[model samples]
Target: MSSTRSDVSVLIPFSKRNKDQEEALRQCPSVQMSDLIFSDIEEKETLLDYVQRVKKLVTEENINIILPTCDLSTMVHAAIARDFPHIPGPTVESCYLAFHKAYSRQYLDPAADLVPYAVVDLDSPTMLQDAERALEKVGFPAFVKPAAAQSTFGVAKVKNYQDMNRALQNLRTMRDEHPGFKSSPSAPFFKDYFKQYLDVEKYPLALRDVVIVEPYMDAEALYTVDGCVVDNEIVRWAITDEHRFDHGDAKFGQDLIAPTSNVRRLTEAALGCL
Candidate 1:
């Protein structure tokens, strides 16, 4: 491989969303970005085609990095980077476990120290029974979200079983109408992959439609720890304090203040997420 430009060039697997990131990148002469009409990963065929398309672009443009612009692109970027050998990205297996909340809980440490949660497969024959058990685990005043989602889109705060029923019903019949569900890079792309590529008995969440139910964590404050892993070492940066607006129930982050503190707990939490 020949290196031409000293400046960095990146390929975002998804199309340009005219986001603030694009504007910010334009201000930096040291950075260049490439995007196309690409959208969500609906299936395995689309995932493979996207991988090949990125491979060609990376070679032709001499792109130095393949960046994932959204949650859906994590695994896709991993697939593209596999061929380059030099491009550094998370492995597909790691990304797979990370992106799906239930999967993360199942395969990772399970965050037993955190709130106990439940996973209910929407398509399961025992869904109602599972939900009943989930309610028992989480009880009233619960938070619900998709098994895999983009940001806070499909998330909802439920004070009762009625709310859970409505949320689950929307997830079943009105998925397209759900903002969080639509915002996601679309489709439960892992469904078929689990059948063909992995052990279904071990990772059965992929076998059916699933959602997460957990106790609502009420806090007077929230913080996000920013950091990066370099050469397999994790370094702490700054922690951002957040305040969420009450959406009839507390939901959205209305205000953010960064560099709020240099706390060791922040670093520990950030590493846990990674």
Candidate 2:
């Protein structure tokens, strides 16, 4: 609430890549910095544990604001925003709806023209039968991915039933190794392994339990809009044209270019629908 940066104390969760982020914030000179241990949602921690930890940290440090820089942190922060109203981010409901691909697809179904034809809740007992029907409807070259994951962790492209089965097998393997997905809460964390499974019943509202299958649109370029909504107003920021590697299936961004007028207008219109 203070106009001067000297009065502002920021609490950023410690991440592996926080060095660059910390350096960036330190450039402001007057902003007080503090670190909160970053907790992965899909790890050993329960919803209660995560909330208690963050609540304790904010209360003890008297944090003025929270800026979540990753997907896991954003979800946790949004869920506990009522405890710290000074934090600037989306509401818990909005974050849940947006973070879960299946939920977002269903929510935006009325505006169906904007979304790709997709099937939801692929982790059910009738998954094979449902997938066969969905594939018939949506056609081949479809994408199979976890409903709530980051960095394309469990994402795969399936051209046929064989590819779909293989992708599903890989996902199952990931789930089996997941700490949260284990039968017991006492399971040890595998530091070298990355898990992408979410316990649906335990954290139903905050986490996604299923996978989504959607028709993949071949686009000339991929664009992303980065912005914030303040006081119910959508603020437009930079739109970047994402460049991808052509060599393999590793779908990582190679470069970014500022959007043109046409791309900007389209991105704004898409944001308006949300």
On lDDT, the candidate that comes out on top is: 1
Whole-model lDDT per candidate:
0.62, 0.55
Q: Candidate 1, which segments miss by more than 4 Å at Cα? A: 1-8, 15-49, 110-112, 176-202, 236-240, 253-274
Cα displacement (Å) at residue 1, model 1:
18
Candidate 2 residue spans exceeding 4 A from truth: 14-20, 26-43, 46-48, 85-89, 120-122, 180-208, 238-240, 246-274
| Candidate 2: Cα lDDT at 35 | 41
lDDT (Cα, tens digit) per residue for candidate 2, span 1-274: 1232344445544244455545645444334444433333435665445556777877777765565654555555664565567655456666656766776877885845764555544356877777778788778788777776665566677889988878776776676667454221111221111122233354352332466788866666777776566546665656767655442443534465765444333222222212
Per-residue CA lDDT of model 1 for 62-149, tens digit only, reads 7656656456676667776666786777666677787778877777565457777898877678877788789999888898888776
> Against the true structure, what is every candidate's RMSD?
6.4, 7.5
Worst 10 residues of 1 by lDDT: 265-274
**Estimated TM-score for each candidate:** 0.71, 0.71
Model 1, CA-based lDDT: 0.62
lDDT of 1 at 124: 74
- Lowest lDDT sum, 10 consecutive residues, model 2, at 185-194
lDDT of 2: 0.55
- Clash pairs detected, candidate 2: none
